[model samples]
Target: MCVGDGILPPGPLSGAVGGKVKFNTTLSPPTKPFLSVSWTFKGVNIITSTSVNVTSPGHTNRITLDRATGALELRSLVLGDSGEYSVSIIQDGGQQTQGNTTLNVYEDISGASITGSDDVLIEGQSSTNLTCDATGSISTREWMKDGQPLQPSDRVTFFENNRMVSISPVNISDNGQYLCQLSNPFSFAEASYGLAVNYGPGAVTILGPATATVDTLVVLYCSARTFSPAAFTWFFNGLQKDVDEAGYVIEKASYSHSGNYTCRAFNDVIDKHATASYSMQIKGRLAQRDTGSQDRGQQGHQMTPTPTTSRAPGQRAPDAPDTPTTSDAPGQSK
Candidate 1:
């Protein structure tokens, strides 16, 4: 209540780190033509001034005072320089005016990091939780995916003022790099995390001949598209075969080889598999036809003998001709 004429108002001031600020005070020049003004930080003298001269050895370059108004100016403020500041003005008649103000300096956020529950997400089987961490007076946060702002969907949720995010039942479309940006009035920082989605071995395809002749060679190929290459297995007639490669070969096809062939593609990363089947048919070789000409002697002449036909193995020869032959009627001949 003893403040000289209660001229200066009382309150606090705000400043940004590595920036400048001013603390204002109003005072009337003393009637005797002699006036003094002094500024103290946490009760330690920072600068002192009179009508004609000003002295602040420790803060000579960064601190200044207004001789007429008793205002204090500070340049390049730092976090350590934040505290209570007091200004006192003395008139030549021993009258004094004093006021105090609190200064708060805020620094920018630094060292931001983003973390997630799983680096590799499995499609339709995995859920992930993500968090953003940083240092400083942060006021707002934003999340981005694939260079675009992330919006909450049926399977995605946000928490902690958007500093944390949750993705449930992840799908193939959810795979990409994610970013977390932390910002304040004075500064901003960002962190990023890579998200991978492990998905199928779906839509298996089999390529091969559907039919083959006996003693002919055949090959069957199986494949599928997947995030991770799938392991292949071949099955024949409801039984597992010894072949594990994507390609199956039959050196020489036989009637016994005809059956339903199946290819199974499995991906371990996503624990998913697909199957495709093909029906194969094998046919036995056909018998060759015999082409021969029958000769009849002209005008009572005896018929000459015809050469016998050569038959393939396992083939039966045609029975002897039913008509009488010259050898059968030997007595009538000659």
Candidate 2:
């Protein structure tokens, strides 16, 4: 207690460089008035009630002492000023009390940033090291990925006072925004980095119709899974086409469009390529598939009537004449 007990509990007070701090002793003028009030650092006199500092040249203009209240203020602090401090007050009635405390000075932190071992990070096959950097003293380092706390795992680790992190065998999921937070008793700072983990150009696929009629609109599409956009190359009948896109448009299909089309996908990061092909056929017209010859044969035979049998003139008309004659009437005797 820096008040009635006149003792500062020996607890350390925090301050940053180039800042000001007031050691509130909470003391007031004694009824008997005061004889002298003095402040000391590490057993050496720093300032007196008369505004005079002896022994420490750095505290010449930065120390203040109140004879009445026994309070002391320090200004324009520096790192070298950290240490044990004591204040003694004596009243005219010969009553004296002393207070003791500790001080911890820290340099303010700033310019926090993260640096990686390599400019480009690759997935599944590449290892990367990231180090957090700042200007002044830092006591703690925290890491975050996409706003979530990042913990050490089998593939992720921290070292060098947690100022650096190592990721081995980078994965596709590692791609995200990363942040590093640095802190100390007096200051805090943060920096961000975009972690790009390049992956594949695999699972190449082509989509389109297998057959299209002549003079029809035909469109073919291509796709693949990749971290970065993949470059596409189209091929017709094993020949490289002039187009390089995910879509191939044939607004008007013709005989020339009848061939096997291939789509090749390439990723520059992994330097790998994949391909898929589609077989397309074009006809002059859909009507060409109809059975025209069979239909014509049936029409040619329609003119002829059904077949009829003819007998020789002398052979006698079969089944008798149209009208039954008297001679041919029954089995009567002639």
Candidate 3:
């Protein structure tokens, strides 16, 4: 075979499976009006053309030849179609030219998966690592959170050519669904993961009456803001109470019930806790009304009435007037 002027500037070409490609041969101008051209793969004749007719194998129906330019076109390429393709051209008076090209065919991404620890992450206390695993030839990778693109910050980083992601000092806002996408020129695949972040019990509050009277019923409620619902505990005078619910009840408040009432809120996921307390006061039943009674009693003391006594039946009444017929004075006869 004789060498041509030169090969094309782009030496190699690539195509996806079931796609098309073209191999341009730098052919010199033929001196004669008629020329002979042939295309070969690894020294096997794939297509050949003479002045009279053209010939090709039965399976090469998708292959075509340009008689004037000597360029080869391949359609619906397969994995076995990837190889060196050469073209030879002959002119009158023994003039010859040749050119060669390499073709590459790649399969698409078929499947993908994600692998990492699914344990609970603590805010400002835990670290995590994740990896993306894909099948077939993947040329690119992308990461997303809750259907939005993931932007790297000081606490987030990527490694292993963007196949792995690392997170440090995780926070409560980082909880969401994460997606990993792998792609090639022909196909794409994706996988997902659910992330859970545990935070603290903050802003503890107790809701109840500040003051109560004796023999009155009262209920105290406790709550806090947290990622995980907090468990409640009631305390009286620094000692744990018998109740375990979020609400505490005093069936009958007495003077003994007056003390520092405290509520403790705790979260088991992050082992965080918060507390709130109220100095409760219990008063006597008559303490509030007695003040008004004393003020009215002092203003009407001068108008008090004389006291009278009641006598028993059959007994002479005290200071009773004597009848003329039944009684006699000391100076008169009866």
Candidate 4:
């Protein structure tokens, strides 16, 4: 018994251009020595004479097998080289064995970009479209928003070209960083576009601590409510921060991080800004007195060192003597 076309392996069809593609098949010679071996494509003889061989389209050489070993070798492939192929071997008493395999070619997608119907959208507005485009041999496209997959809906229309995915009727809900993916089984490429679907420049609010200690971890959070495509800009001490994400992280914090932290939310199309600011202070421990009279000595007189006094709140204590007094008892230089 021998394995035939009824038991050949399956292969992938899609591939990238200028990339390699291989077609393979396994053959078992029954319990008899083979008389001859040959390969074929589309039912046409690949070689002129009977010999163990492997043939590829558009190649000058026909890969041949060791007459005594019955081995196969194939090299140098192209797009048109993809197709159905078969191998047949002769066994004892004229019995024959054959098998078949399929090959697929693939290419890459490039030049991806983003565009829209209109540059902006107002509150309670109907809709528009956001398009992601590219050029290449991509078989299909995938749409994503903020890294999540988008499905088709009445508000959403997925348009596909040779290398583009356009979402029509875009609404405020569709404002975000959108990514388009083009792919074949062998290669994939992606591009990103940002949407600032503007509605009323939403209200911005600070979500965290109003005061913190020096050198401590602090997170100043800002949230824009009732806004579409919230554009956030964070400021440290009135300077814009370079952090790109929703929040910023500070390590080994110090008093230098303390300032009027501000977050401004806006949409370019709407030409509106909603800003929120938080007063942050990094407090430190109070300094201790070097001497008890150090504070009193600052008042511009020579203060006599006296015992520190404690008084109830709102109660007054006797003032300390300013300096040594000169006096005569009875008759003096009055």
Candidate 5:
């Protein structure tokens, strides 16, 4: 009743993330009369009798043949439902014949976002916590730093429950790239981020000339430790000046540009601004006049560069190395 070696089409082998699956089987008649058939996946019996179907991560399906329709059907497919499937059939008391097919599943994690804020601390002060949460069927969570498995340490803590991995108490020792992974028995997925903590402004550098030519454009830069893009304000000659976010630029800078300059920054979440000041002197016309008037000019023109060193309102200065200057002028420019 049967012809040459029987052939079976490859199984679906794959399923969408949180989606259903459908399967099918084909048969060729042999010389003997029609007999029954059975199906199995990875050696796990999916159906005891010919043509069984199932879902992901398991073997479950019923094989049914309609003599009138001459067709076979499978239903309710899932990711774990993917694998090599085998079928055996016996014809009219003759020997049995078997055929094999393979299946694959494709799925992705959902709802991605960074657990920590845009900014974090890295220095050995404290641990910063970050997490990744996603939802889907067959969910799993994995943690990473610099694209690698996050290491365990006193400086770094990773807490995993379901789809969340929390990295806490961030420290300088923890500086690096971070990410989290999620998956189900059928498929896998992930997300990532980089964490750099707050320190303070770095050495202050004055822009323009150390000694500017009178009538020349006077520009001053109050360089601080670089941080997340922050609002910056420049104070020139001890007075807040119209300037860009990071540095100050004066058109037709005159004697007014001479004196101390400072730069202050504020985080979006905070009410008060932090400042960094530097003593600046312009050697041209205005600053080169009489010593007495110059001293008076310098009095109001001098500003301090240190800003509050604490991130939290009432906390002590972060453990990172801050300049010897602890406190700065409170009324300084915001």
Candidate 6:
């Protein structure tokens, strides 16, 4: 039968404090005539149902007996009411039917929570303790990290009734969500805590090109490895850039853009930072002298020089190669 509250699902019979319990004993049809019915708690007779009304001192108001079924119902249950109970019924000619039942009473687990230090957990540098606490009947307490059981190691230990977990020095591997589970024969409850272990801003790098041509756009990318997301700052020639993002852009490359660029990554929780530098040299395009040489070729520089010839009576000499146009390119002078 359903009580006021604090009842668990089907399994072991259980009751809550201030609720009710029942000794589910059904009487067999009378073979002859009913004689006496009695109920005992822990071998101490607490009630007797017959023509005469008899009951234990304090149990009179909280207990009821059904003479027809030999069933006993207990109300206003308390923790001390839990124990072994027995029922016996006697009929004419001294025939008796006896049975025993056990009752376990528990209050609902409530106000379960996990507490810990709020400071940042720096790898190899910080230590902290997490405690699980509650207000009700907690027969067993368990610790879990990220949905898995949390095992104790050299740096991890439990004390104070296994309600607290202490880590001597936190590390990157210890970063995860933690939980506390509390349970009893009749009730269950849990609480969770998110644990963050601050690690390094490591392996800083620039991902873009180290050189760009004049009058061309270029972008420089920076990155780092960290346990938590990090803030990035860019620097050009020892001066910090106005932009705080990981990508830096130069609309047009010029000689003034040639210098060393540095990237600095900072972790928010711990006192750690990482830096990397890339030197970029802005290069000019091919010289105008080279372009001029190409134009001269198209005009006449590629033609064979005319050969000198004597002419008489206003006749022109035949034009032929005397000496090809002299070349002045480096290593090609002739």
lDDT per residue for candidate 1 within 101-219, as digits (tens), equals 78878788999999887456788988998899999878789999999999999999999899899999898888889999998767899999988888888889999988888999999
lDDT of 2 at 136: 88
What's the lDDT of the predicted structure labeled candidate 2? 0.83
Please give the RMSD to the true structure for each candidate, in Å. 12.4, 10.2, 8.8, 13.4, 27.3, 11.0
Off by over 4 Å in 2: 1-6, 26-28, 33-38, 48-56, 88-98, 184-186, 236-240, 254-260, 279-334
Off by over 4 Å in 6: 1-12, 25-30, 33-35, 42-44, 87-101, 149-162, 227-245, 286-334
lDDT of each: 0.83, 0.83, 0.81, 0.64, 0.57, 0.82
The sequence of per-residue lDDT tens digits that candidate 3 reaches over residues 59-146 is 3578777776777789898878877778777766666767777777767876688787777788888889879988676778999999
Task: Tell me the lDDT of model 4 at 139.
Answer: 69
Per-residue CA lDDT of model 2 for 1-334, tens digit only, reads 2222454544678889999877877566678656777788899887766343343676767877655677778999888878888888777877788888888789989999999866567777889888999998788999999999988999999999889999998899889888999998989999999888887787888889988989999999999989899999999999998899999999899999999999999998778888998899998774556576766868656564696568887676567667655655577676
Better candidate number, 3 or 6, judged by lDDT: 6
Query: After best superposition, candidate 6 residue 93: deviation in angstroms?
Result: 4.2
Estimated TM-score per prediction? 0.58, 0.71, 0.63, 0.51, 0.43, 0.69
Error of 2 at 14 (Å): 2.6
Clashes of each: 0, 0, 0, 9, 43, 3
Candidate 6 per-residue lDDT over residues 189-291, each given as its tens digit:
9999988887889999998877789999989998988987889889999999887888888998899999999999998777689999999989988767666
lDDT of 1 at 179: 95
lDDT of 4 at 174: 75
Better of 1 and 6 by TM-score: 6
The residue ranges of model 5 lying beyond 4 angstroms of the native Cα positions read 1-12, 16-27, 39-72, 78-86, 97-109, 117-122, 138-196, 212-220, 228-334
